[model samples]
Target: MGTSTAYGGPGGGTPLVPSWLGSDGDAGGLASPSAPPAGAPTKDPASPATLPPAPPTRLAIPTPADGSRFTAPRSNFTRFAGSGGSDRASLGRAVSGYVSKSSGGARQAAQRMGASRGSGARLLGFLTDVQARGATEALRSLDLEGLAGRPIDEVFMGLADYICPNAGTVDEGIAREAFIETIVDLSTLGVTDLDALSPDQMQTVFELYATHAIEARLCNDIGTKLVTAPTDPLIALRVQSQLRDFIRNGVSDALTAARAETPNLTQDRVHTFVDTIYERAFGILQTLGDAEADQ
Candidate 1:
């Protein structure tokens, strides 16, 4: 759950791309050429110099409307847990049932983003287009370029919006965060060339985004709603961490299973691929919940 402000600096020991790519640059882009030197003799109208300079290629900055925080529901469990009426097993069952019931809604949210005409599908189209064409061509089609020279984090936020298109929903926020996180992670994972990222790299990005989104969704859904917080602050943090890891394991398994079934992951099939992953992931989560209830 890193915030956008925390992304200002590159923390990894060494970036896979050139140092400049990870460093902050003139976000304003080149200022319009100084009015052609105040009436100095101009080149022929037909000459390249006479052509208007290309628009400044500024990376997009996110506005408040672009993203929102997940609003957790009031903790109904906390109300009764303090009275010694509920035990850990009952709490576990309540969490499992609640999350399992919510799985349908989560899957619907995922579908809205993954289906054709959704931002997630568009994101996949961009990646697959990169694979079919070159990265440069794909970017051009999307009106994005000069990425080789922009700050890595800036490029990340800009691209996140393009990929998820903040519908102002919690799910979209989760997806956008996941997209940026994937980029930040890739900076250390041998993704040396942003302008020419390979198809495998693009697919890796998508897959990681999906994993992060699922984990975030689960965490938001379960936080303090079904499980009461431990009194110790350190224990609370650890509990949260462990909960994330537990859910992430199930998500990973689902993605692995889905990937195995659809070995070729192309744009045409990305929607179905993602839908299958969501279905399997919720199923696995429900199974895990059932196990917890038994315990």
Candidate 2:
């Protein structure tokens, strides 16, 4: 599939995801963005959806010492763009290791904060609900077959509530961003209509969402401010792009490995299944990271 640089960001138009993604639902505040009018036109094929950055508040991470901050051991990405040979391998290890560790820490922190459900868990819950009760019964007026008529983005916006519930936390925002990015990636693969999505395509969507969710969660935990941005604007963007691909590749591989054991999912086993995927994904990443470091 061809790639596009049309992703939404800081300077982009209105974000494709919900504006209230991280809102706490205060008395006078909105809990979600207003839906487009009933007859809104299908999304223009020529234009791609743009996703905004995650919420500004970051998950707290201890800063490394200034001297060691940019090295491969820490996964800061400072040396990743220009490195070669063993150096590139070391940088990859750092990226994988840092993401794996931060993902675990973020999960623990979310549990302690009473927001234990992440995007993958939430999405699994939705699937389980659909399984227990048919899609029409589960979603009331929106069956799986009905999705064929709507624009793909509209379907995504409607599904975001279930996939990335309003948690009022950085994690929720990261999850929301990941979900939007997944739609964009799907478009590249010619998945423009919701009803046309095949079984494998749907599985691919979930896989990619899990991949992006893991990477986005780790990046937010690491924080752009903590990682010293390259002085040149273009180099910084390139580094950011490369670093995302590197971390995403590791997570994607991990998920592929775990998918080998995927069972015929039941409502009762949904949570356990999603948890196992995450556990295995991180475990694989950590092992690969260690091997990379030792190389």
Candidate 3:
């Protein structure tokens, strides 16, 4: 009697296994010795309609645990000509020039106000005055009614394009460093009280510093670019508007972050803190502007 030819046997053309079973050995129970070998082309390739649906992709959202220090991605800005080397050097020069002049102005204002660099309270008061006067003068022309409902950061981000249209032209790294240095100088003026804040609150504070630093650097770059015609009233107003919006948004973002991190943080306390920081930054700019005019 001849051997049964139900499965592939000698001189049999039929495969021992079905072609639908994946050829990989790891196909688990679905795989069988009767399946065709892996990598073998199918006579009729599987159509998209026949394939199983792909699993959905999930997006990860950043949380407070991710840390509060957020740096903008470098790719967000355009690369400078000759790559980053020359661009960086140019940006460094601009930062150095602005910091030197602004620090001198701030020191002079501090002395005149009888507020030592270490006196946080007196310095805060002085900054408050400056901010009020600067903001009043800066926004006297523009209609700000539309901005009342927007998030502080969103408003500032929008003004970023108008205030410092050329900011994207500078190297992001150099601009970031300059901004960080400026924030440190503000700390020397006793603007921030680190001991009073919780760790999470401190993170929010640093995030605000980082945000404003970038904005200030952009303004500085804009000023440097306009050195030839600095007296243009229109240009000055535009820069002032940018600075004001930057301060406003920086304070708002810090408070918002603080609230998120510390649920117990009261809205009233956040408002007070935001007001203080915003005024202080605005005042500093006002003094800086005055010193520049005198020079």
Best by TM-score: 2
Compared with the true structure, all predictions reach lDDT values of: 0.51, 0.51, 0.33
Off by over 4 Å in 3: 1-172, 175-179, 188-204, 216-228, 232-247, 254-258, 261-295
Return whichever of 2 and 3 wins on TM-score: 2
Q: TM-score of predicted model 1?
A: 0.57
Error of 1 at 109 (Å): 7.4
User: How many angstroms is residue 272 displaced in model 3 relative to the true structure, after the best TM-score fit?
Assistant: 26
Clashes of each: 0, 2, 5
Per-residue C-alpha lDDT of model 2 across residues 122-212, encoded as one tens digit per residue:
6655545555554445556344455535666666667877666674555456667777888788778877664455546556776777676
- How far does residue 128 in candidate 3 sit from its true spot (Å)? 28
Residue-level lDDT of model 1, residues 1-295, one tens digit each, is 5322122222122221221221111013334675554335556667756644445445444222101112211133343233243344443454455444432333533432331124445566677776777666776776777663565455556666577664354445556666666677777876656556665676666666666565554444444332344555555555545545555666678877876787667777876666676666656766775686587
Off by over 4 Å in 2: 1-75, 81-87, 96-117, 125-138, 141-148, 223-228, 231-234
- Which stretches in model 1 have alpha-carbon errors above 4 Å? 2-95, 103-119, 149-154, 187-192, 195-204, 224-234
Q: What lDDT score is found at residue 34 in candidate 2?
A: 73
